[model samples]
Target: MTVLFWVCTIGILSLFLIWRNHSDQKKAKERFRDLKKTQYGASPNRNSGEEALSHVSHFFEDHRQENAIDDITWNDLEMDSVFARLNYCESAAGEEVLYDFLRNPCRLNASERARLERQIELLQTDGDVRLQLQYQFYMLRQRGKFSIYDYLHLLDQEKKRRNGKHFLLLFLLILSLVCCIFSVSGAPLFLVGMICVNMITYFQEKGRSDAYLSVFYYVLRLLGEAEKLERIHHERLQETFALEL
Candidate 1:
């Protein structure tokens, strides 16, 4: 009876979680669409501080070279204000990419420039593709004051964990659940012990690699969205992205 109760409770909770996630995602997409409609060509309303702006520049700084704009010249040109004026990205990653583009103005030849212009033209004209890509980026939304690059740097310090113990614990958990169903003597106690051990192991692993886990999730989300982008079926956009689908 207790096992049945637990199973029912877990099933209900899982359904609730799935429904809530779907609801939230739908709401978010609608909100993003409304915002995009209202804010098109409008001046940016985001208040960017020096620290926040600096965080966005981490990727650019990391890959910056001799031809890149120097700090003195960047400040002299008041590029921060310029960045804020032009910034309309829905994610930190997008902002970082834009920042890098601005800082290292690519020396494109005539053919390259024409191709880039055509890409921009398509984005401006193709509302469906534009909104689709925007929503994907919006799904990759920034959280808090830190950029993805910040978490990525911290992730470098995190110790990598092997999956062997995790798999073993999972197998043991399943075996214990089966034992419980068969009404084996002391099976309930064994199941409880397995649950406790699993909880402890999970938290210990999370504590050790919280940063790594966060970054890994972010990267996975990014890649997932990129894959969706690749499936958009626009030949020009596919060429522009140059992603191997």
Candidate 2:
């Protein structure tokens, strides 16, 4: 009777976990669909169109180089619409790269352009491959507009000094550990006190560190996305993935 009850309990728990995961995946898919609709949907007004145009223009202005595709040409060619059509990228970095590619038409020679066209054709025809890539990108998408380069530049501008408070906390933590190992009578009390001090110090220092921490988080996320992309075995994207690495 006990064995049967334990087996049933494990089975019930497994089912519950499976159901929860399925539900979460369904919600994620719905959200992704909604996002796609919003991105590609018809604008409700001329104002919205102008807003989007301005946003794109501003992005180019900030990031453009001498050889990059100019605003005038981009507008003339209706490349915004083109980008919307071709953008199946899941990550912010991928989207930005696609935007750059569209705006600053690379000086690809005839043979190279043909090869690219063939790769694009492959991407279009292979739904499974596209879906896999999109899933990867979705996993990598940030909650807000994150410009990697901009954040990196900000990180560079930050001072290189270490916080003495952090060192003090670290020393206390080590001392507390040593006390515990030596079976010191007041070790637990000292550990608790050190924890409280560290918590107070942490909150006080958090404001200054938040920006740097956010940049580090995004950088780590980008690296993870790149690693995933590199693992995907799509011939069309082989060269592109290599470049990303």
Candidate 2 lDDT over 1-245, as tens digits, reads 99999999999999999999999998987786565556543432222244433333334456677888766787798877777666555555665666766765764678878877876776567656656666667777643444555656677687787778689898998899899999999999999999899888888778777767877887788788778778888665676333467
Write one digit per residue (lDDT tens) for candidate 1, span 1-245.
99999999999999999999999989988888888878777898887778778678888878886788889999999999999998888888889988988888864568877877877888888877788888988887775566688778776676766799999999999999999999999999999999999999989977866666777888999898888877788777777756574
Best by lDDT: 1
For residue 53, model 1's alpha carbon misses the true position, in angstroms, by 0.8
lDDT score at residue 143, model 1, on the 0-100 scale:
53
Score residue 206 of candidate 1 by CA lDDT: 77
lDDT of each: 0.84, 0.69
The TM-score measured for candidate 1 stands at 0.68
**Model 2: what TM-score?**
0.57
Q: What TM-scores do the predictions have?
A: 0.68, 0.57
Write down the RMSD of all candidates, one decimal each.
7.6, 7.1
* Per-candidate clash tally: 0, 1
